[model samples]
Target: MNDEINYTNNPLHGLGLQELLTQIVDHYGFEILYAYLNINCFKTNPSIESSVKFLKKTEWAREKVEIFYLYQYKNLPRVSSEQFELPPRKRIIPEGQTPREPAELSFEDAERVREKQAKKAAEHGKSKRYKEREFENLWKR
Candidate 1:
């Protein structure tokens, strides 16, 4: 007997990025997407192709779109009152509903999150260096 992991509870499993974008575009036009996400792809001459290409290349933007889908489109229940949150895989899905698969963020989203963290870390390093320089300058004076 083969044991297969059932992901029926997940709301983002089987859906592809293209389909997700299409559904979103259909439900809410580019204008609304632009207003909501503030992505340039939606703002300036938006098209599925262009948006998909941009999303594929840019991780942060893709994560934003995925987050929007999880919150606005899927309508999943909120986790708790905690300020910090768990990743989607750890969160429990509501029972009795056939959740859309692919709940986990896409590869692009994950990469984007990493890139964002790296950028923040770089900025923090810069700040630290600046502070150290200022301290050294004070000593020199």
Candidate 2:
């Protein structure tokens, strides 16, 4: 039994159109690639298929695509062995820093607010009675 060449488990293998576009973008500026590819996707939201179609048909566009592929491979960001972690920073306060004073509502003010709320509720009840009169007429109809 012969083991066939696996396309899946390979470096820089099975590169999809979107991935190819993204990699090319990361390496070369969008404007340069747009000029090179002459594809609408590169210029004004041209799709991968449209770009691929243009490139496949035109040799110049195909050359640009090859150049982009090479650029992407060369300038790929190296995977760092060292993991990046944010340093545990201690928030420092000045030596003479004072805490804010606690806010407390006075009993007289509280009572006044309660009385105002009761007055609003009574007003609301009066308005509600008028609305109920309309509903009673509707029910009769």
Candidate 3:
């Protein structure tokens, strides 16, 4: 008797890439997607066909879109650290966790997120430089 539980509960299961992109684009529009994802394909002369082609050629970008689709479009709860490391499509949804309504997203919110990320990156760069300088001083002493 097979005791293994089927873990194909992921919303991405059996979904095609083009279909996924189409759904998100139809709902969110390219501007919002570009704002949130920062993908050039969405920002420059955006269309479903061209974006799909670019995503197909780019693995990392495709994964980014997949993650966006799950957590943003589907509004699924964040996964655990172990599952978080897996690709969004490969991750399993825990039992009893059904997708909720799509989160309300706006270009303004995306702008805020981008600004916060930029600020954090700047701070991180400063701290790294400070630490390197400190290490060099230790060697000099």
Best by TM-score: 3
Top lDDT model = 3
Error of 3 at 27 (Å): 0.6
How big is the positional error of residue 12 in model 3, measured in Å on the Cα after superposition? 0.9
Candidate 3: residue 33 Cα off by (Å) = 0.4
- Taken over the whole model, the C-alpha lDDT of each candidate is 0.58, 0.41, 0.76
Q: After superposition, how far is residue 54 of candidate 3 from its true place, in Å?
A: 0.5
Clashes of each: 8, 2, 0
- Backbone clashes in model 3, listed as residue pairs: none
The sequence of per-residue lDDT tens digits that candidate 2 reaches over residues 6-57 is 2222223455545766665655546655543344657876666676666557
lDDT tens readout by residue for model 3, 1-141: 121333467888889899999999999999999988889999889999999899999887888788788878888876776776676677888989898878788878788766765666566675643432322222121
TM-score of model 2 relative to the true fold? 0.31
TM-score of structure candidate 1: 0.56
User: What's the CA RMSD of model 3 in angstroms?
Assistant: 9.9
lDDT of 3: 0.76
The local distance difference test score of model 2 is: 0.41
Off by over 4 Å in 3: 1-7, 125-141
